[model samples]
Target chain A: MTAPVDVSLIVIVVVITALVFDFTNGFHDTANAMATSIATGALRPKVAVLIAGVLNVVGAFLSVEVARTISSGLVDEARISPVVIFAGLIGAIIWNLLTWLLGLPSSSSHALFGGLIGATVVAAGLGAVHFGAVLSKVILPAIVSPVLAGIIALTATYLAYRTTARADSGTVTKGFKAGQIGSASMVALAHGTSDAQKTMGIITLTLITAGVLSPDSGPPFWVILSAGLAIGLGTYLGGWRIIRTLGKRVSEIETPQGFAAEASTTAVILTSSHLGLALSTTQVATGAIFGAGSGRRLAAVRWSVARQMVVAWILTLPAAAAVGAVAAWVASAGTVGIVLVAVVAIALAAGIYAVSRRRPVTADNVNDVGDDAAVAHEPAVPAR
Target chain B: MTIDWASLGLVSVVSLAAGVAVVVLVSFALVGLSARVRPRPGGAEDGAPTLSAGAGTAIAAVCLAAVVAIVGFGLYVIVS
Candidate 1:
């Protein structure tokens, strides 16, 4: 480890970058919990995000098991430096912005893991990454959780429709809308429990590498509080672009379908969080939404849109890893190199934001599918 | 490094079961509510329902209570 005095400055810089990444994570994933709720008119856009933001804060205080996993289990803290963690954060934030610009609901968790693993490999060699842990905890869970969520949602949605087939349509819609609000709130809370801890773990790992904290220590109370607030703030801002895609472009979500999708997402995310598995909330939500679509009728699903999201999922890890590796190489040269990387990252982020402003999607225009000609032109899925 | 296949299996089974159960219960509750005969807004005479309205209301209440209990249990698992 480096001398404590020499590394303290680097540690502070790294922590801020991690918080920035956490902020992007918050907005990038806001759609996962609230998209269907917003789309179905169960809650207004502003009210939905406010509720999600508060619940996320409450959920962040729920458990520390996942934090322990990221701090010590993923990569060797001794081999990597705070600078490396900073580079990894840069990679994740950039990937998140790129995907968000394209309105794709990619996995923020996977991007973080990929960036960290990639930067570690470049800085400390391949052995620094525990491939075994990655296989069991990260890779395997990513594959299974989404498929499982999809199947459960499919069955539940089908059963839901069948059970209520003879019911008065007006009463059924009202009841399911009420149920959807409860389920969506649970999903938001579950998201806070899982996603916020990834940042906490990265910050804790940075502190450990700086010689400020011992190895394998859990996040301090302050770390948890700041991480929670950062994410909550991001959630409140909302990711209207991705929300539009998930809510309107995925399929026409009825009240029952929305309820089923949110419930399945809640169950899978909470279960994984309890087990300390860092599964992707985005994937689970996407899968459940598709499942809900398919359950109603295979014809009801827009397979082309689903195909595009899956392609994004397949690319997120490798793409983020590549950027992270390049960033680590550049940042490792010296203090000057680190400053250059930070400058370039900020410039690139500003450029992306400028581009996004050209055809902006905000809460007022989020559900305006008819006015947005591009979204309207997509071939419609025939509802059964 | 070693994959805990057992834990993986447990998570998968539990999540799937819980997801399906919650949906089913909520749907059944809605169905039960629909079965009950609500007095019309214009004060029309209530039509006789196939199932007794009292029984349907009872069934709906029980199912909704079960869903609430499960959600509470989920919250407890997170905190403790």
Candidate 2:
């Protein structure tokens, strides 16, 4: 049999793929952080993205802990090769693109985990997964983080409006829109700090697996800059499909509600990041958005859209994991495996782009939610 | 096929990731709290003045610098 493929080339390819995944994550999730503010006229779209892009770059510079978690805590890196991780990232990239095209706010965190898990299990059996870490760090947080943040936001929004009940609606809207800029910016910063690092950790781990870096080494400067730039550029591109869904479909977010949601999101996300807990920014932001809507008197929170998002979140990990595992198995076969994986990735990317063209959601059409009053009265779908 | 460099690398990467996360979280807490507690000129009517384009850019700069240092140091530790 031919000798095992060149390890260095594999490492480099994986690293690049990881960055590509990171870039998609940036655009896919940027809507989670800024949709409400943009919807409420708090920040202009271009300005909002510029602000978010800058914060994401800064945030990437902020933390390595989450990166470490992805690199080491979730899976036994020793059992699997860097090539395995590369295959997993390919799975993640595919899932991310699929969700982005649908404008579904799924969990990128889960996607990554699923990808890693799939590859690892295929490479080294179920023993590769750190179940304890998965339970304590991933599952527990996934279940509670969003709900907890939601309740807090709901209460905060109610009190915010009640306290200022005497103020004119116009006055409150204008004012909160202003406050939203700051809070939204903070969330973006936190997003960058936490999410970018995940990719960095992955790249660093690849380096370690390839014996290019020590096991305990953090991600290098070039990795950090490249990841930061990739994510920042993605954020600038903006995921308008999700923006439409979140900003207009979930609820008709007023300025005050947007402010409250952003503020609550900033607080909860920042706290979780500090605790070194890997939380889904999508979940946290979604919870806060719904909570803000429900808190307002007469403001309708569409459980239908919320239900859809939740469903997507629950399925993200397993679905992506399955994809990753398949990719890993194929990639491990030999030269053909590598070629097959690359062809699949390219084909999948092109497919998603083609599908997205049918009902293109750009900044121009992003705000077209059709009669806010009518949508508010739409029937709710049961939460699954 | 080799020593458990993967395990060591994993641990080191985790610490580096966590350390940076903590710094960002703490910084955000401080900034968020300060914005809340500090007295403001126009109250909530005019929104927040400090969260401008310039402010966002500045925060990003700090974040980038911190990430570079943390990762760089972690790599050094692993290599040595």
Highest-scoring model, DockQ: 1
Give the Å error, residue A239, model 1: 0.7
Cα lDDT tens digits for candidate 2, A1-384: 222355467777888899999999899888977899788878888888888998899788777767776677888878889768988898899999999998888888889888988988998899988887787678877887677667666766776666545333444455466667767887798788878888898888888888877888888888898999999989989999888888888887877678777767766666566556778888888888888788775337887787788889988989889989999999998768977998989998999999999879887778786644435567333321
| Global lDDT scores for all candidate models | 0.87, 0.75
**TM-score of the first chain alone, every candidate:** 0.96, 0.94
For A161-240, candidate 1 gives per-residue lDDT tens digits of: 99888666677899999999999999989988999999999999998888788877888888899899989888889999
- TM-score for all predictions? 0.95, 0.80
TM-score of model number 1: 0.95
Between which residue pairs do clashes occur in model 1?
A: none
Off by over 4 Å in 1: A1-7, A371-378, A381-384, B37-49
Best candidate according to TM-score: 1
TM-score of chain B of 2: 0.45
Model 2 C-alpha lDDT versus the unseen true structure: 0.75
Error of 2 at A101 (Å): 1.2
